[model samples]
Target chain A: MPVYNARIIVTLRSSILDPEGTAIEHALHELTYTSCTNVRVGKYITMNVEAESEENAREILDQACRKLLANQVMEDYSYTLEETEREPA
Target chain B: MPVYNARIIVTLRSSILDPEGTAIEHALHELTYTSCTNVRVGKYITMNVEAESEENAREILDQACRKLLANQVMEDYSYTLEETEREPA
Candidate 1:
């Protein structure tokens, strides 16, 4: 079986108010980074999926994101997949 | 002035414990996603950085990551930078 590394990001909808991000943005401004704006924060998740092929790996991860990692009503998710050599048993 | 979209990911160092990730991994197993392993979670941050050039944008974001976005002792951070057209005033 080939093992794929999946990196997933779950972000809030643009219209959502992200207090965490807003606080960070304010902190940055206080730190003299006044030009930075519109800060938003999300989740970054990574895991290994062992499957027969790349497509299978993606399917499994997509399911994970849709079913568990993200909330459909308020959040969106995206993932990047890369194949890695299977670890020795 | 050029505007850049910065996407930053801050992850815990490998040796650090990630309870949030562990709980999710267990939930995945219960959901029958047994092939998923070594799940780790981090923060994804997006912001608009208005700077003179790509180099300046990278520098500013790097500083932000170091100063506040990541805890140096337990976390590691990386970012991708893309230039975007300045929004019309």
Candidate 2:
């Protein structure tokens, strides 16, 4: 089976409040980078998926995102896939 | 000031133990996604930066990443910038 490196970016819906991002904004302001604003934070995940084909790899990745990596009700996720020769750590 | 949207991804160094990732791996395994492995989790952040020029926007973003967005000793971060019409919330 071929191995695929899946990089997923999970972001909260714009309507949701991102307190951590707001906190980071204040921290940046305190650090004198007041020009930085509207700071929203989310999740970036990378995983290795072993599958029989590229299409199979994508299927597994999508399922993983929906089942565990993201909360579909309040968050959305996007991913990029690449072929890799690595396995799970 | 021109506003730029900065999207960043922060990931722990490979040498660092990502307990969160490990936990997710177990969850995936439980869900019968045994093919997915080496699951590493990270952060995705998006912010607006007001600067005088593209160069200035990049500079502020770099500073934010170094000082607040990522832990230099344990994590690494990278970003992409795009001009936007949004402001702080």
Candidate 3:
């Protein structure tokens, strides 16, 4: 089976509070960066899936996102897929 | 302060076990996708940071990643910085 790499981005909706992000923003000011402003936080994921075609890859990816990769309630996710020349780690 | 959007990706090193990824991979085969193979999971975070320049943004982002975005023991992180024409949410 061919291997495909998927990069998934998950982020909290704009309305939610990000305590960590806020703290980091404050830390920047302490670091002497007065220009620093609002900061929001999120996550980045990379995964490899086996599939014969892009459509198949998409199908597999959708399953992965729905079942495990994303939490649909507070965070929203989007993914990009690419074929890999080397085998997945 | 100018607003910039930073996309952060944090993943466990290749040697670590990912239970959620494994479960999702298994579910793919259950969904009739036998071709699916190794799947790794990680987080994709999108954040808005206020900074005057890419260099300044990077300085702030490094602090953010070290302080909050990533767990140093198990995860490694990388980020991309981009300017947003619209105000951050």
Candidate 4:
């Protein structure tokens, strides 16, 4: 079976308040990184999957993101998938 | 002044055990997404910055990541920076 590497980025919806982001932005200002603004914090997920084809891998990853990796109501998720050779055992 | 958009990705060092990742992986298996493996979870941060030049923006973003956005002991961070035109009032 071919292996696929998928990187998923899940970000808070703009309308949602991101307290983590706000605190980080405040810390940045305290550190004198005053230029930083509009900071939003989210999740980054990387997964390796075994599948028959690239399309199959994408479908699996999409489902994973939609079901468990991200909360669809408050966050939006996007992903990139690439095929890789299986490592020699 | 030019605005720059920076995306920062922070992930746990492979040596570190990611409990969140493990939990998500278990959830995936329970959901019957059996092909998924080696799931790692991290932080995704997007920031808008005001800088005179791209180099300045990159410097500021790097400082933000190293000092405030990521804990250097157990996590590793990387970022991408792009210059964008200022939004009109």
Best by TM-score: 1
Cα lDDT tens digits for candidate 2, A29-63: 99999888888989999988889999998888888
Considering only the true interface residues, what is the Cα RMSD of candidate 2 after superposition? 0.8
Model 3 off-target regions past 4 Å?
A13-43, A66-75, A86-89, B86-89
Per-model TM values vs. the true structure? 0.97, 0.92, 0.71, 0.96
lDDT of 4 at B10: 98
Candidate 4 residue spans exceeding 4 A from truth: none
- The regions of model 2 sitting more than 4 angstroms off are A86-89, B85-89
lDDT of 2 by residue, B12-82 (tens): 99999999999999999999999989899999999888889989998888888898888999999999999
Model 1 C-alpha lDDT per residue in residues B1-89, reported as the tens digit of each score? 99999999999999999999999999999999999999999999999999998999888988899999999899999999888989999
| Model 3 residue B46 CA deviation in Å | 2.2
Candidate 4 per-residue lDDT over residues B5-58, each given as its tens digit: 899999999999999999999999999998999999999999999999999888
- Fill in the DockQ of model 2: 0.86
Candidate 2 chain A: minimum summed lDDT over ten consecutive residues — where?
A80-89
For every candidate, give the share of true A-B contacts it also has: 0.96, 0.96, 0.58, 0.97
- Writing each residue's lDDT as its tens digit, candidate 3 over A1-89 gives 67788877777877888887787667756766555566666766666767778898898778766776567877777889888886546
| Candidate closer to the true structure by lDDT (higher is better), 1 or 3 | 1
Model 1: per-residue lDDT, tens digit, A1-89?
Answer: 99999999999999888999999999999999998999999999999999999999988988999899999799999999999988999
| Cα lDDT, model 1, residue A71 | 94
The Cα local distance difference test for each model comes to: 0.95, 0.89, 0.74, 0.91
Clashes of each: 0, 0, 6, 0
Encode model 3's per-residue lDDT on B1-89: one tens digit a residue.
67788877788877788887787678767876666577667766666767678888898778767776678888888888888886546
How well does candidate 4 score on lDDT at residue B85? 75
Model 3's TM-score against the true structure: 0.71
